[model samples]
Target: MNTQPSALANSAGPVSGDSAAAKSRVLQIDRSCRLPLMFLIACSLVWLVAGGFLSLISSIKLHAPGFLSQSSWLTYGRVYPAAMNALWYGFAFQGAMAVALWLMCRLGRAELMGGKGILLGAFFWNVAVKLGVLGILAGASTGHSMLEMPGYVSPLLFVSYCLMGVWALVTFHFRQERQLYVSQWYLVGALFCFPWIFTAAQLLLVFHPVRGTLQAVVSGWYGHALITLWAVPIGLAVLFYFIPKLFGRQLHSRHLAAFGFWTLAAFGGWGGMHAGAPVPRWISSVSIAGGMMMILPLIAVALNWHLTARGAKGPENNQVFRFVQFGAIAFFAASLLDIGGSFRVIGEVTDLTVFTTGVKALYLYGFFGMTIAGAIYYLAPKITGCDWPSDQLAKLHYLGSVVGILVLVLGLVAGGILQGVRINNPEIPFVEAIRSTIPFLGLSTLGGLLLLAANLAFLVNVIRLLALCCCTNCFASNRSPAGSGPAAAGANL
Candidate 1:
């Protein structure tokens, strides 16, 4: 029941003159990073569309191989990897970076410095992702699951990440706030851990390939670390920041928050190896134990969020609150499924089929993607000094996204179970197994279409908002008094 030092020291309080100045500085920092963040978000949206297209194609090829059999590039093997890489690197990572940068600035209570360098880094990061996706399509992939990008492209990504990481570190070091909140801990840990984990994986898996099953071990570790250490923390940071703010309350339990963070850090790395690779029995056991242990942190987080939001009213009509709530539920559900699937009986059936894919989609789209969307919805108006262009568009996006992800998860889970059962029974014809999956695959494709439509609506709304901000800035700058141009323009924006 004792609170951690960070939790006790970092409690929110009333604003004073110093705090008011900090708020002003935060606004300036946001303004400085606005363009770069927008660029990152826009690239993410574009990649979402591209990934969606490739996903649909890949899904279709599963049931109807002859649909795009003419082109070698469009073959199922290449297209599936391409779709995954585009979503993981292109859309997910970019959106995470945007969210992370904003959180770092706000929580650190520092004005953003080195904006140009971060901007340049973001540009090259996108370039590397683009080249990596193209290389994957061109059959230059290194055959590693998540690290499939060619050897040549890895350095570009690593260097760009280092550049971005340095900016984050520098900002953290110079932060005006002395006591770090839970969100800052998550944000800092994720930023620092990513480069290390990624570089090690690249070196072991790509630069100097590991032998045999060790490569699989490293790949599993990398994939898990990417989600648990990087993506999950980013999502959690946003949730931790916004939940209390929206609900007008303090966090439910600081002690629980501390416990959750440390426990997750301890167990998440080992948990990823449970994907039933052919490594060793002890490895799988260790992973299963890790996965089971994860339930503690998951329960801790769920309880904390629920307690924080208890008695909160009117959030259903708010876009940001609604998205975060949905994301929270998805995260808890995904965790339960992950733990359940770690059992030998379930893992035997689910690990090698589309069920695993469903779990992953639940995390990436339903959890991380939804939370990021909420953060964007809440922050965009503040950053641009303009409200959302249309509430109707936001409503459509929310509905489509929730419906699409639910349908996709359900279809994959049901189909994967059937496929797993058929595969285990060697007497069943492979053709029949394939035939059984056709209907579910079709449903998944429909769900994907709905998601794509939602993303397009979001992208259009963002573009309109950005254009308005740009026009406002220009008009304000031209009419500003001498020596006050920059200040006046910023005020208008």
Candidate 2:
């Protein structure tokens, strides 16, 4: 009785009495959490657009240093980190929080009853991110890679995170359903583990100010954990839940899933050592080994997703599947690329270079961003019961994202490798080496522009949907919603 009214209605012609009841209960869960989740989504969208602009600025600055050189607050040192934090903390994390809460409620077969706390927490989280970004721009940063926010900001973030995160755990704990899905495992783990890691990093690196290179070690550990244990798990949870649910199939293998989960949990945190970290040899050795061992988990997860998606399910939500398929491929590819980077040769050359930027693009925008984009599309219709207003816009958004990321990643990866080679070669002057990469930087700027355009399209699409939900049909049609088929969902992208 995993009820999805629009998804189910799109695939199948009719629903039984049980499905009708299930849909009712599901709708209750959706409605219970609607305000907070939608508020989060809305807030996240703003940050996404704002981040895109900041990203565009940063990208332009790479190739053209004189564009906005007058403003100290807009310098690359400040703006780059600000853009990164905005997207990571503001857009990605908020979207994940909303999606995670919805999944917890759905899997638990319970309403998100106490939602005011979540809304309040989300509000505070936004305020924290805003103030934190301002701090970074105004030169009050703590100077850590991921933890750039001022020390004062971390506590508020932690408290707000706990507010939203605790409710998700409560929902999971009080689940009406006895059996927990694979997604639940990842979500629950991500929820608890991220806070633990974040808190530990704050204590050692920020509050206490660790001595010597140990500070770098802590920062590296926190950065890696942010993506690996926190962001990746949240992305995977959505994929694991949606792929099976959308395809109307059970997960391919429980054993494989268990193996994947444990492997990731065990080996994932053992990472964080840089190419030539000043830490002990054994530390880097352990990290490299852990990364190499991650191949097993990657294999398990990839196989499970592939096997689960092999079956037939009529004209599925084209938009949903398209995004998921791309995201799944990106996830696997990024994981492989990341593993490859663990080797000495690749690590040495690519360390602190734009090649690493390519990997991040693959991970952040390609995998997590796209998955969440699809989820937003799917969830929007379900939550608001409004058919998409425009297919062209949706397709445009997808195209821009896909093409932009490809161009951006390719430019950075190729440019980065070239830059690394020049840096390593004694004959090449350092300044000359930097100059040679300008062409590639221009290419990335183009890609950034495209991504910015794509996000703007998404914003418009969402606005249109809101208009439909609030006006026109005026929510009357929302109550007893009309069906949405492949044609209706269209190559909604």
Candidate 3:
């Protein structure tokens, strides 16, 4: 320090060798974990396209009720539930399982255990989702928002999830790494919480439907926890992995992560129960207070990631970076909407309007969708042993998703506010309020199509990548490459 000039050295702090070591480790991990990642991407694209189409139909019906009213099978109620089933079970659940498998392997530093079992679980899960969606289309839905699939489907889903959870847990158990990573904490909690929450919610809602306003309250509670238990954990797991990996550093605030995780566990499920209804004043007030309190953990998470990435020039090389960046931003926005929607005063006007739909879209598409998209991007190159077919294609996918979701959310919000104003105004006819939403609904349909197009392109890219993997030249080129293993070839999904 005495010999060195102040202008020539970093004054903030010394860059530890550990930071460099962490960066190298992340690069190595990314390089090794490829094949399973690609399969996850393929599944996500397929479900997004299916979900987008359903959303398209639902949005159109809002403006023109007669568009698909002729067929009982295609009615809005059936179509909307079926669409959600596709997105939730088909897209989100399946995709998260794949990502969870990969992340556990990388973070736990272990190879996947029971490859055949994992594939079998995935197969059964898909079969369950397929039958469940068909049931919804046939008017056999449980008539609840998140638990729409008929009671029969729950057993199949339960079996499938249990099997897959076993694979992930066992993989974590066998990892060579001595210290448990923060990502593993969330991952373990998620895998454990899913079966418990899902079984209980299904039992209560399907087997013993609660009466009156309590039913709505319980339904909202289940819906909120469904996302919290399934999507939020995965999103947090991804954040824990990518931020540290991309920035070539350990989480700057591991203590902060633990606090945030526990806080979410304590508070997340209760806030959504305030979705509608004039519950006891104190009850509604507590729920709103809980929603507002979520701001702390949310901010903690954002800071944890941001601090890790503080001085990094850019993220690591891959498609994963593109998808994850969008997801991180969406997570912040989704949390803000949650807090906003929690207020009873706000809900009084927006409760039945399109704003509720917009809130749903923000959580599903904006938050969970983006994370899944990023996982796919990160996994494809690792599995295929070839760079993404085109970086431009990756950019297009993320851009399309962001633009599409924003447009759809904005259109719905604007329309919802307009509808609320009209409904509240005694001077305006109800038809006039309903009619005003046409333009906004029109905008939503356009956004849905845009999202659909993006998903199609993503699907095509994945298919092409898989084709290349099967190619004689590509297979030969990858045969003896670094980090390739039976797990890569055995992905089988």
Candidate 4:
């Protein structure tokens, strides 16, 4: 494999004159977005913790319905939507934004411009999410999956997102590097596509309100597009950026990447509607065809990444690489599952069941969450100028997350299949089908608890690191000026 020095590697290893200069430049760029990145990550952790608690309540309520039945606010309907909103908007989007912004700055070789605007944008984004989640709990939910946030909160989110998007575009415009990397393509695409999908969904589903079966079609399209175009693209950008860097090589094939990118762009938007929806036959068929066609791009991407990582396997021991690799495998696995589930025969059994939920968990937590975790592990130290406080914590987090997600997904799939079989049979009682899923639901709850513990460990580590950084700054500031002394010293780390 042909290789070149990665942006991150410019600051690693020996510190000769040229190397020192290169490292300094990289640190300077990193420092520019430090505040914004830290803010995003911190907010994401807060949301992760909150989401974990909500999820635990939700999971428990699945089998033990009386657990919180007395509290109207904690009812299954409200808690479920609250948990989903917290996880999706609070943790997922924030973490993804942090990763995307940081990667864009690093790849562009440009210090992030409009730092204040970006920070302000992040603040408003969190505010909007908070209001949206609260509204859902207050029974003001729009009742659309992934678009559950109430009507009023939509504009706040859209405006905040536009601010951040503007910063991204401006940063890219003023980049030092003229040539765009494959990761850049993915990042830019995600940045641009989100608002369009978000706005259209808001208008069709929430504001104007689509009529009858067309509502299902729009909902299906919005859900699928959001995952494929927004979440998956962000995750893929990280994979493309880090795989070669970790392996000390360039990507296996740029041509393959381009092909993958365009194919995904062309088909992913239309592919998600076939998931056992109540739409017309033509609509479902188009979705299935699009999904089947997406397999080619997924294969292209998987092969490129696999071949890149085939040789230098030493870094696979590192937590960042390990998480990324796990996520990459999960991505391919999830893709295959989606393709199979899109078929009419399989969709008939899996649609509107726990099986679909299992696939979503695999994609969101297994693939997107894992990849973002890897990116955070890799970038946090660089941005904060402090090494992670403990490798033990990192390892614990990785084990818990990976195992928890797998168990949760498997349990859901098993439960869904059992329920689907019973439900499909005319002689079977609905209550009996529900009863058959209790054990698996319990297992899923256990998995959620494990993940909660893992995230708490991560939160502790981050807090410790931040405290250390603050102490170091305070100590340095006592001896010299406030900004220059500690800031320069931290940046050099």
List residue ranges in candidate 4 displaced over 4 A: 1-18, 478-493
TM-score of 1: 0.92
Alpha-carbon shift of residue 339 in model 1 (angstroms): 1.2
lDDT of 3 by residue, 1-493 (tens): 3344321111111121246664454444444444444554566568778877887898788778999799999999989889888988888887788888787876665556656566667778878888999999999998777889889999999998887789788878876564666778888988888887787778778887666666566677677777765588888887677766665565777689888888888777665566445655666676678778788779888998888778785554656776777788888887887777777788677768888787778778887888877776766666455666666666677778878988988898888878887898889999988898889988888888778787777777778777776673345665554445535424522
Q: Indicate the residue-level lDDT of 325 in model 1.
A: 83
> All models: lDDT?
0.80, 0.82, 0.74, 0.82
Which candidate has the highest TM-score of all? 4
Per-model C-alpha RMSD: 4.0, 5.8, 5.4, 3.6
Better of 3 and 4 by TM-score: 4
Which lDDT value does model 4 have at 424?
90
- State the lDDT at 357 in candidate 1: 87
State the lDDT of candidate 2 residue by residue for 1-493, as single tens digits. Answer: 3464433322221121266687786766665666677778888888988988998899899988998989999999899899889999999999999889888877777767457788889999999999999999999989888899999999999999999899888878877765677888899999999899999999998898889988888888888888889888999988887787667766778789899999999888987887678888888888888889889889999999888778656245488778877888899988998898888888887777898888887888889999998888878776665788999999999999999988888888889888888898889999999999999988988888898899888888988887776764444554433222211211221
Candidate 3 runs further than 4 Å off: 1-40, 275-283, 316-318, 472-493
lDDT of 2: 0.82
The local lDDT score (0 to 100) that residue 297 gets in candidate 3 is: 78
